[model samples]
Target: MKTILITGASRGIGRAIASKFASGNKIILTGRNKPMLNDTAEYVKKNGGEPVIIEADLSNPQNVLSLTKSIDITQLDLLVNNAGIAVVEPLAEMTLENWQKTFDVNVTAPFLLIQQLHSIMPKGATIVNIASIASKEGFPNWSSYCMSKFALDGFTKSIREELREKDIRVINIYPGAVATDIWNSVPGEQNLSEMMSPESVAELIYTSVAQPSGTVIEDIILRNLHDF
Candidate 1:
């Protein structure tokens, strides 16, 4: 069975992805919330997968380093970088602390984790970065979020090129507006009905990872049928 490690696996798209892979593989989940991580582990077990939990706050550099140090990198078949945060404010109103925190979790942490894990990863192993549509286009009040995702997109592209010779697949998934708690933090009236379900995105991720060994789905863009 393939061994998968997913960061931010406590809720939303991360939780859905873990459940999708819970049939026969080993799933290692990491998140800052210990209680939510435990709940996710229980869900994975109920779905017939072996679950392991690693509590980590990716915003802290030391915690990110510790996470990789604790993992058996050689045995990892897939690594999903799904942990991220969004801070919504006009450019003039955005604080330096918020901007740095967004980059710390969304961009820097993923880079460090991949750098540490890629060398020990077996050939044909896959790395998936959960990015957002904001990576491509800028939003008015989403400066920090957009910048972080943009950086993540660049990182994914660079690594994909670098790892081509090694036969490792690096994929970037840009998912538009999903109905998740992430929106609760942003100041806006979201039409939840118009948003895509996290489960749908998770299924797409599962499909990409399940492709033939020789084939790699480089990028996937998922959006709701109707615009919000």
Candidate 2:
């Protein structure tokens, strides 16, 4: 069974991805929500996969290093950097703390994970970052979120080439407004019904990662018919 490390696995796309990849695999689920993580673990176990829940608040750098300690694997077949936060504050009203918080989880944590786990990711391993459409396009009141994703896009692009030399694949999945609880906290009314379901995104991610080692699905943009 392949070992897959998935951040943000407590819910949303992360939880869906864990279930999609659960059958006959070892899933390492990490997220801040302990109860939700347990629920995901149960789903994974029932679906015929081994699940290990590692509770970590990606916003905290200390917890990022502790994640490495709990992961017991010679090689990580897949790493999904999906834990991220979005604070909908206009640029003029935004505070440095919020911007720093966004970077801590969205950018810094991923960087640290890749660095800490680099040695264990041998050739053919895949790293997928759950970026957003905002990564490429700027959205009003989403300055901090957009900026972090853009930085993530750049970081992943640079490493994609670096990892290419070692035959390891790095992919960035840019998803449009997905129907996840993440949007619930963004303030204002969100048209969740028009958005793509977490399962849809998870299925696509599973499909891409399942491709043969010789081929790599570098980037994907997932969105529903209606762009949010």
What Cα-based lDDT does every candidate model obtain?
0.92, 0.92
What lDDT tens digits, residue by residue, belong to model 2 across residues 1-228? 999999999999999999999999999999988999999999999999999988888998988998887787898989999998999988899999999999999999999999888788878889999999999999899999999999999999998998898888998999998888989779798888888999999988988988999899999998787665
What TM-score, computed on C-alpha atoms, does each candidate reach? Answer: 0.97, 0.97
lDDT of 1 by residue, 110-211 (tens): 999999888877888899999999999899999899999999999889999999888899989999999998999889687777789999989999899889
What clash pairs does model 1 have?
Answer: none
Q: Which residue runs does candidate 1 get wrong by more than 4 Å?
A: none
TM-score for candidate 1, residues paired by index: 0.97
| Angstrom error at residue 219, model 2 | 1.1
Prediction 1 global C-alpha lDDT? 0.92
